[model samples]
Target: MALTATGMGSGLDITNIVKVLVDAEKTPKEAMFNKTEDSIKAKVSAMGTLKSALSTFQDAVKKLQTGDALNQRKISVSSDSFLSATADKTAQAGSYGIKVEQLAVNHKIAGTNVTDPTLPVGEGSLAFDINGESFSVDIAATDSLAAIAKKVNEASDNVGVTATVITSDAGSRLVFSSNKTGEDNQINLTATDTSGTGLTDMFGTGNTTTLQDAKNAVLYIDNQKVTSQTNEVKNAITGVTLNLTDADVAKTTTVKIEQDNDAVKTNVQAFVDAYNSLVTAIDKMSSYDKDKKTAAALQGDSMIRSIESQLRSVASGRITAADGSSIALYDIGIKTDRYGKMSIDDTKLTKALSEEMPNIEALFSTPGQGLANRFYDLADSYVKSRGLIADRETSYTNQQNRLDDQREAFSLKMDQLTARLTKQFNAMDLVVGQLNQQSSGLVDRLNSLPGAVKKS
Candidate 1:
């Protein structure tokens, strides 16, 4: 009935020590569960890499969707042929008369020692008038034309001008032009210092020429002067895609670039893939087996449930169409089945996309109003929601601390008990020694008494 007993053969059992040690092993399992919970929690903890400002990209595409609303428009093509673009929509069906013009770059005066226009010449520079703005830059005699070119490039702030040098069979001549639009955007160049030892009179003619004769070309759209430039003009506002076939005076030609359907399709696919990746992750984590009674750690998380609902809601949302036909993502061929997987009916979607585009746009692209827009917003919000994962992680931390304390206490108790048990066993050893001494004395006395009796 002792509260405790200790020794090598004491009646008390050491099974509690064994049982507790076994229980301690459960920590690893708990740790794994905690880690999984943290992972699930982390799904909401950090903001996802965003879909690259979907609105901005969508707006850019939307602009393409509308052909410029001008009867006649002119656009200048870039000298660098590497860049190319197409309209998002074709011009309204019409007998569109198109023309392309090519201009030979005028290299009137080449600065001496300025082999490449990019290299600069000392105390030598070109002057030009752009939109009534007067500008003069003094190029040092030794400065390579390249150095002078850098200064011109940086003068975007002062002269409202930019300069480019076009190479021709004749040689390189400084080509300075107005960066602005309208009739005022003309360049008048005069050699400021063509007299230095470094300066050479390359312009056999005086410092003057028609701006059109220079690389700049004047373009008229539908008999309207849309642009007059010392170089090609980019009339982005008009949306006119100009292909310059020749820059000579009265040049006649046609330039055409069609709508870029492939780009739009690629963008759509990217969005679908991103969204599906998120869905797939959620589906795997939320899977459950009723018979087995097993559920994933994130199965009942509110955030997960909310995310699923928002996605479905967006996919099912409706919008009005141009032809008064009602439209929805489903109508446009985005299908979501019971298993929470999404697949697009490409044929149906594409037909709706190209033919009834306004309807498709209405379905998912209202700035802050459409279903797709709202759904993305919801996803953004839900991904930030707080919940159980964080709570459990905290609990695990607290439990680990408590376990450490409990183990320490138990170790101290075991040590004390061991010491007491050893002391008790050592005392018993002294008692056994005393008993041996007494027994030996008794044996000797009995042996002596027997011998005396025999002699009698």
Candidate 2:
């Protein structure tokens, strides 16, 4: 006979007993590996958060490290319509009387009018002289007025020349304009007709009218004369760029360049904000709640502790001031409280900026001893490739990989144990069924020999 189902002949739940035994052997080991994997993943995630916070702080530090941050200038013009201006750090703080006499213009010319745009002009080559560069386009007899204009625009060697068609009461005419400004950058056109197809007659040398003349911009600054080929004038005053928009001989606009104290204050505030955010992030990661019996992911981590310590030191360190007195962040109104939180005193900060602006800037950005430089260097070491954060993440990843291998091995072992247990229990059930059969045969033989009446 075929083997009975598991536990059927023995009247015992052999399958369930095997399951209980297998679970007892496998559950605790799997739980341990899973817990390790979770801990490693949390560490990797915490490292990512730390790197991001450090990068934000680094950006703010870089802004303070530049020379422009201290020497920034603001420009104001009396009339934007007359002229607009911008000044850089090199510009001196002063006022200048600016009078724009004339704005630079480009040369424009229109061809003689014709009845229709499609009408053929002639069959010849149209030569152009633009800014001393010479190029030409061949004209066919079948080429219309518009067609000739298209050919002129499509010329490969044409420099500073644009062609268009204009229709007025005088009829259809081709127009040409110079892309450059100033009198020296004029557009001159001449046509040659070999087949005498009237192409030269339509757009020849005499068939054009000067619509606008090219001229340079002329201006006066504090009684000093200035001329520019274009409206945009650079270096008219050192580190100042002037844009002359309109001409007004009788009106004058005053241009002023001055130190931008407000901008500097704003930059300082941004730095403070970024610094505070990073501090808060670090604090949260390293905090502990005694009452709740809970700790943060990076609590007690040596690397994180070291990073926080270095950052705080840089913030509070003293640097040699211009007047030989040591200065630090507190002198500039950036102060930390007992709990390591930062707060800015606006009144004190503004006063310090107004009185000792240079000293304040120098205190935070003075070469190797500068706060920003030290902070940036520290952050870079942690965030850059092969840095502290990267190495920590690598360690966690390796741990996770090992845990994965252990889990795979445990699963394989559990599977083999289950198969072996099932086979052993099935063999025990078969033997028990054979013993029951033998016992039943012996009982029937004893009943038959005792001459006992058949009790029904």
Candidate 3:
């Protein structure tokens, strides 16, 4: 007694047939929606991969290119003292002490005025004017003379100042002296009340006096001033060279600090590889296939378009050279077609890199600046654009949610339809049973007296 619109048998019910047909259509729609969701998910994953690759490529490029595009720079170190850059590469110029023997050493002598043995004059104070900076310190009386001396030695920023304790038949007194032997090296030392209550009791204060007088020594490197007692000059080179001599007077010598070639080669190779990898990715994204559609995720993506455009613009931009002519990507052999896939014109690139490298570098990176400063900003912007990969992921996520909601709603509706069909089918089953009973009764009444053959 199944009800259906199109009956396979006479007993088929119409309502059941309609419900079955509708549910059948819903099943495929749900599957199709699921397939679409999966597709979107795949696209999101691909976008993330691409974005990650771009970020890595940008970092690599920045590392390789950031610097004075010039591979080598020569630094000269000279000292007035008899010192020179060691011929042996294993030696460090800093290890050699120039004019150290003549340098005045500060000696400490503990005053008899130490009223407290626990607070013995170990903690002392010394103030000195160094290169316009006022340096002041208070030492604990309990601190050993050696400990106090260590503190003074550690304070190298002060002008040629050093400290030590002198033990003699007279007793012990802390002495502050200038290591440099010169009028310029003369230092004015004044012990404060907090340092010890006995300044006039031990060392005279009130007048400008040399704490300890030693012949001021002079040192020159490559005719440049090297050292003085109160002299402010430390290294002739701005942190680039060191004076390695022991003489107190001026001496002429040379020290060579050369560019690290190995580092330069490593950076260059890294740049080439990163650029090539990025180019390969771009090629894959833009190329077409005979059996498949263009990478749909990249299709109509503004980020990809912008990246390609900027990269092309950078590649084509001109760089002004010292000779006044302009430099281009073509000059460097980094040529790209309208699609933006790149190939190294090896010979051209080599010639430009070797012969007119300054121009090539200026085009990609500004002179005297890191490589990133030149073209990395664009690459950075392209890679870090808003609503690019994140937007794609968000869109996919939204669609997935929407589809899931729809599927849930559809399932509920289908369940309701099935429930209604089941109820109607049950009702029809009872009706069929009643119809059979009525037909049986009519046949029984007709056959009561006369013989009747029933159609089976």
Query: Which is the leading candidate under lDDT?
Result: 2
Off by over 4 Å in 3: 1-23, 64-67, 74-132, 135-189, 192-240, 243-269, 285-306, 336-357, 367-374, 385-387, 440-456
Whichever of 2 and 3 has more lDDT, that candidate is: 2
Number of the predicted model whose TM-score against the real structure is largest: 2
Off by over 4 Å in 2: 1-3, 58-65, 132-135, 154-157, 197-206, 309-331, 335-342, 345-348, 355-395, 451-456
Query: lDDT tens digits, residues 349-399, model 2?
Result: 888877777787787778888787888899999999989888888888888
lDDT of 3 by residue, 1-456 (tens): 443333322356656675777669787988898788877776676677677767877787675463453343344445555444322222223322333324423322233323232334434576765334457566766665556667777875665666666666654555566554455444555566655454334444642334455543355444444444423334444334333345444333455565433443445556656766776676565456658754554555676677666666665667665677876656666666654555665666556555654565455556533344555665655456563566666777898898889888888888787777766665666677667767889978997755677668
Which lDDT values do the candidates have, in the order given?
Answer: 0.51, 0.85, 0.56
Deviation (Å) of 233 in candidate 1: 5.8
Which of candidates 2 and 3 is the stronger one according to TM-score? 2
Q: What number of backbone clashes does candidate 3 have, counting pairs of residues 3 or more apart or in separate chains?
A: 40
Q: Sorted on lDDT, highest at the top, how do the candidates line up?
A: 2, 3, 1
